[model samples]
Structure formats: C-alpha cells, structure tokens
Target chain A: MPLDPSFVGRTYPPTAPYQVGREKIREFASAIGATDPAHHDPAAAQALGHPDVVAPPTFPVIVTMAASSQIIEDPALGVDYSRLVHGDQRFSYTRPVVAGDELVCTNTIEDVSTRGGHGFLTTRTDVSTVGGEPVVAVWARYVIRGEA
Target chain B: MELPAKTFQVTRADLIRYAGASGDFNPIHWSDRVATKVGLPGVIAHGMFTMALVGRAVTEWAGSPDAVVEYGVRFTRPVVVPDDDQGTEIEVTARVREVTEDGLTRLEVTATCLGDKVLSQARATIRSAR
Candidate 1:
C-alpha cells in the first residue's frame, strides 16, 4: 500500500525546546571532521561577535529530523522505514542558529507520490526558538522502495 | 544536557579532500577567482559538505550511520577560506537531548566556522538498535 493522501498537509506537534551548548557543538564538529574552532570555543566565537558558538550552516537538519519522525512513524503514512533513502534536502534560513538559544521544531507533510515501484515523500520542518524566532525551514524528499 | 567543550581545525587539504569525497567540484570551493566571481570573498566550502561533517559527528557518536533515522540543516552563512598561510576551521558540538518512549534519541547540536555562525541550528534523531 502507498501513503495516504489525507496525510498530506498534516502538521505534527512542536518538539520540546533544546538548548544549544558548547560541548555538543565541538563533538559534532569533530565527528564531521570539521576542525573549526568557532564551533567549540566561545572565546573564538565571541571574537566573531556571536553570543556563543555558532552552528554550521546545516545544523538544523539535526533538530528537524527528530521532529520528522512523527510522520515517518505514522502507520497511516505506510512508509517502510528500512527501505527509505534520502532523495534531496534544502534549507531556507531566517537567521543563523547561535548557541544559548532554546529551540523547537514542527514537522509537516508537504506531498506524497509514487513512481517506478517507489514511494516518494516530501516533508517541511520549521525549527525555531521557544519565543517563535524563525531559525530555518527544511524541505526534504525521501524515497521508500516499493514492496514489489 | 551538557558536556565538555572541545575544538578542531580545517586545513586547505581538508577542503580538497571533501571536494573529492562528496563529488562536488563547485569552483567556489576550489578556485579563488571563481569564488570571487560568484561574490564570495574566496573559496567557500559546500554547505552540504559542511553538513556531512556534522552527520559524521552525530553518526559516529550514535555508533552507526543506520542509527541516524533523520537529520537536517540550514546554510546560514558562508565559510570563507582565505588564501592565508593558516587554513580555516569548522567546529561542532552535540549532546543527547531526550529519549523517547520507543527508545528514539534526539540530539541537540551546533557547528561553526571560526566564530562565524555557519550552521545556525541543528538536530538529529538516532533510533536505537532494536
């Protein structure tokens, strides 16, 4: 069975607030092999005029992905978790995500389709601060192999 | 959640290696002239490449790429790598935020470039092994 069309436009609840910290930033930087000081050192980040360490350009994916599970795990969506592969991803930012800000995310299903024995799902997630400060919007397409 | 802060560095060679690894040859990432033509100060790194670094961070921390059920990021700023003697550096940090009822783990994370906000806000979900 394919995904439910009714699921399109469905919006999930907002994720809990997450506080940005220095250590988490450094660990992420090192894991990605990003040897940049600004990700870990507040003094370096301060020199660059930020409240604390600033995240790299693609950091929102972390939060948004967590929020997206609402849809992926929905039995109504009929998505096969084991067969899914990332199709494409893009982000539009209202402002940079600096450390020390409390953040949350809301995920919404944008579109659903099928082609050549595969299910295609598109999702849009909004990551923001608790006070509703827009940080970034993530648009992603995922592919699920058909059960042929 | 909190952890000890750490640091890292990005050398010129790292950019070249990333270019090769990701199969993205955007001249803006390798050629100063082309980068400047596009309005960048100098060679700029690919946004996805930077994010992949973050992915590696989260995946390694989770102990498996397959564990990363979902992840995303926005390119808030350009990581400008100058033609100076010392190369630019991109840093990152991550921590476990929560564990869901079904054993899903959410990570709060951030990555930066030499103090500039390169990757503004980031997060990921790691599905624990069943």
Candidate 2:
C-alpha cells in the first residue's frame, strides 16, 4: 500500500518528557563498545563541560524511534511495518545529550513518495529539553518494499 | 589527513544486547526464521547499531565524546552476521574533508563488511580537539 502523501507536513503532538538516565547512557555505550571515559564517568564528562555522563551521537535514535510510532501506527497512513527497512539516517545536534536531561520529541512527516515499486517515507524528529531548548534534529527515511 | 581505521566485530550476542539497550527488538536482527521469511541473508545487525559503532569511531577521532555536531549515513547494504562465535567485522575509515576556521572538522567516512560497502555518503562534522 502506498503511503498517504497528504501526511506530508503533518506534525504530531510533543511526547511526554523522557528522563535521560546515567545508567541508560552507560548501557548504550557498553553495548556499542564505546569505552570513552566521558560516556561512563560523570567526572570525566564534567571535565569536558557536560552536566553528567555524555551520550553517544546516535543515542537520540532510542527516543526518536519510540516517538515515531505515532505515525507508523496511524490507521490513516497505512504503513505496513513488516515491509519497512531503514534507508537513511541523519542527526544535527545543537548540543550533546546529557544523562540528566529531560527530553521531548515532536515528529513530523517530511516527505512521502513512491518509486520503483517501493514506498519511501521520510520523517524528521525534533528533540529538545522539557523547557524547549532544542538539542537535535533527527531525520530518517524508511523504504517499504513492494509486494512481489 | 586520514584518520586511523577502526574495526568492530558484530556477534549475535551483541545484537541481543543492543536490542535490549536500544528498544529495537526487530526479529530480523535476531530470529533467522523471520529474517529468511523477509528475504534477508540472515540475522542482520541493526542499522542503528552499525551507526553507533561509527559514532564511536568518530568520537575517538575527535578525542571527545561530545565532539560531533552533525552525522549522517545512507544504509547501502546489509551487514549479515552468521550464527557463529566469530561473527563478522565492520571496518570504518575516514578522511579529513575540511577544517573550517570556526574550529570544526569535517570527515568523509566509509564503512565496509566483508569487502562490501555497508554505508554510503557517511559523513560527520566535529568540534576540533584543542
């Protein structure tokens, strides 16, 4: 099924605040084998001017992926989850995410198109502090394989 | 200038751990049955996972965890991992694209697995280390 082109430019409500945890950052760092001391030690991060343990650059995906469910599950949009594959990802950060920050995500459908028997959907997620300080803008493109 | 290349090994166990940590429990990354049903080569690593490893390499190059200002990648090919203890290896290499006067360094990165490029147009901009 083709995605609803009308969904382009549609923006969703801001998600509830997600509290970033030091442990969660540590776990993500460990999982990726990121042994940088700043990713694990508060003192190390503080020396580098961060409030707490610093998250890796790709860490925001954890929040954006969950927040994106608002669009992927929309009955009106008709996204077949089983056929979806990640096509592209990008992040532009105003500042690195810290362990103690409370973040919120606002999802927007940036583009929807069909090409070569495949459906392509692009989404932009604006992540910011609970107080509305922009932290990063994340973009993802998903390709839905056409039926054989 | 060319940054030192970094190689990371991807095992099935790492995928499970990443799934638990990242909240991405897609069966195509773990269950071979679902992966084959979906026409995948085998249980594949999450694209985010591969990106994370590249992020690690970028931070290492910059000598700081918070150095990255912009990062992006196109998932060009799947990094297939067999159900083996050795698994597969991903090698990441980067070249210095430019250094702006404002103390930012731009890098053009490439990631490959088994001689096949897995990511394309991979790039990053980081705060230059003092």
Candidate 3:
C-alpha cells in the first residue's frame, strides 16, 4: 500500500510544550562531543545574548521527531514504520534554542509519493515558543524501501 | 577557502548514550542482535549523531558556537561500527563555497567513514567572523 498523497499539505496541531532543560542540553552536547561553553554554562550563553544555555543547532530534532509521529503513526497515512530509512534532514534556525524555553512543534506532511516500489515522505516541523514565537523549521525526508 | 579538517570518534558507547539522550532508542543503533537480524553489519551509529558532529565542526570553523544559520545533509551511506574498544572514526572536511554580501559563509562539507563517503550534499551556512 502507498501513502495517501492527500496527506500532503496537511498540518497537525501544535503539540504540548516541551520544557528545555539545561542538563538535557548539556547531555546532548556532551554526547556529540560539543564542548562549547555556551552549551553548558548559562553565563556563557548569556554573554552570547541567549537567555540560558544554548542548545546545539541540531537539538530541535529531539522535539520535532517526536512531533512527527502524529503523522507517521496515522493509520490513514499507510506508513510502514518497519521499512523506514532516513533520506535527508535540514534545519533553518531563527535563533538557537536556549534552556528554560517552553517549545512546541507543529508538524505538516509536506509531501507524499511513491516511486520504484518505495514510498517517500517529507515532513516539516515548525518549532516555536509556546507563545508562538518562531524558533526554527526542521525538515525530514524518509523512505520506506520495498522488498525485492 | 578551505576549512581545517575535524575528526570525531564514534564508539558503541557513544551510540548508546546518544540513543538515550535523543530518545531515538532504535535498536539498529544498539543491540547488535537486532541489527544483524535486520541485515546490518552490526549496530550502527545514528545518522543524527553524525550530523551533530558535523555541526560542531562547522561551528568550530566559523569560530562560534551559535554561528550556523542553516544546515542540511543527505545520508548517502550507513556508518558501520564494529563492536570493539576502538569503535570507528569519521573525518569531516569542507570548503567555503561562497561568502554572501550579508556576511554568511556557505560551506560544502564532506563526511567519510572507512574511506567511504557517508554523506552527500552536506552543507552549512554560517555567520562569518568579523
């Protein structure tokens, strides 16, 4: 079965706010070996004009990936999670994520198509403060490979 | 302009830690048993983990932690990690593709593992140092 093309351009509601914790940012930064002070020390981040410890550029994936499940897990979409492979990823940031920020994600199925026995799905996530201030836009392309 | 190369070590432990922190507890990133069952050489490193390392490289090149304005990558290959103390290594290199009038530098980045290209069309735009 193929994913419904109608899902394209369908946008989901904003998810519940996810509190950005300093320790979680620190842990993520540490896992990637990003030892920059701005990722750990709030004072250092403040010096850089951020409200608190700043997350690495890719940190929003933590929020957006979870939000995307609303679409991928949609029964009507016909997505087969077992065959999924990440095709690509991109991010555009309005500002670096800072600890203590309350963020929410609104996910949209930007495209859905099938070619050569594979299903291609693209999702865009709008990450913002719970107050509706835009933070970043994250896009992900995933492929569901069909059996030979 | 050419950017200095940066190398990152990817250990199985790092994969486990990244999985826990990122909430992407995908078994292919851990649990060799499942990975092999799924036809992978073994447990592999997460693609996002690799991208994050490249982001760190880009920021380091731009001389600031918050310099990246945009970044993107296509996962061309899976980085296979053998279960060993030494794990594996990824080497990142980039060239300045352009410097815009608005003071952003565009980078064309290449990431490789085991002498094979692991990412294609990998690029980043960053605020150039003053």
Each model's TM-score, in the order given?
0.55, 0.98, 0.98
Query: TM-score of model 2 relative to the true fold?
Result: 0.98
Deviation in Å, model 3, residue B107 alpha carbon:
0.4
Candidate 3, A1-148: lDDT as tens digits: 8788988899998899999999999999998999999999999988888889999989999999998899889888978899999999999999889999899999999989999999999999999999999999999999999876
Alpha-carbon shift of residue A109 in model 3 (angstroms): 0.9
Per-residue lDDT tens digits for candidate 2, residues B31-102, read 999999978889999999999999999999999889999999999999998999999999999999999999
Clashes of each: 35, 0, 0
TM-scores of chain A across the candidates, in order, are 0.92, 0.98, 0.98
Pick the DockQ winner. 2
Please give, for residues A1-148, the per-residue lDDT of candidate 2 as tens digits: 7887999999999999999999999999999999999999999999998889999999999999999999888889998998888999999999999999999999999999999989999999999999999999999999989998
DockQ (Cα-based) for each candidate: 0.07, 0.95, 0.88
User: Regarding DockQ, does 1 or 2 come out ahead?
Assistant: 2
List lDDT for all candidates, in order. Answer: 0.71, 0.95, 0.93
Worst 10 residues of 1 chain A by lDDT: A27-36
| Deviation from truth (RMSD, Å), model 2 | 0.8
Compared with the true structure, the alpha-carbon lDDT of candidate 2 equals 0.95
**Model 1, runs deviating above 4 Å:** B1-130
Clashes of 2: 0
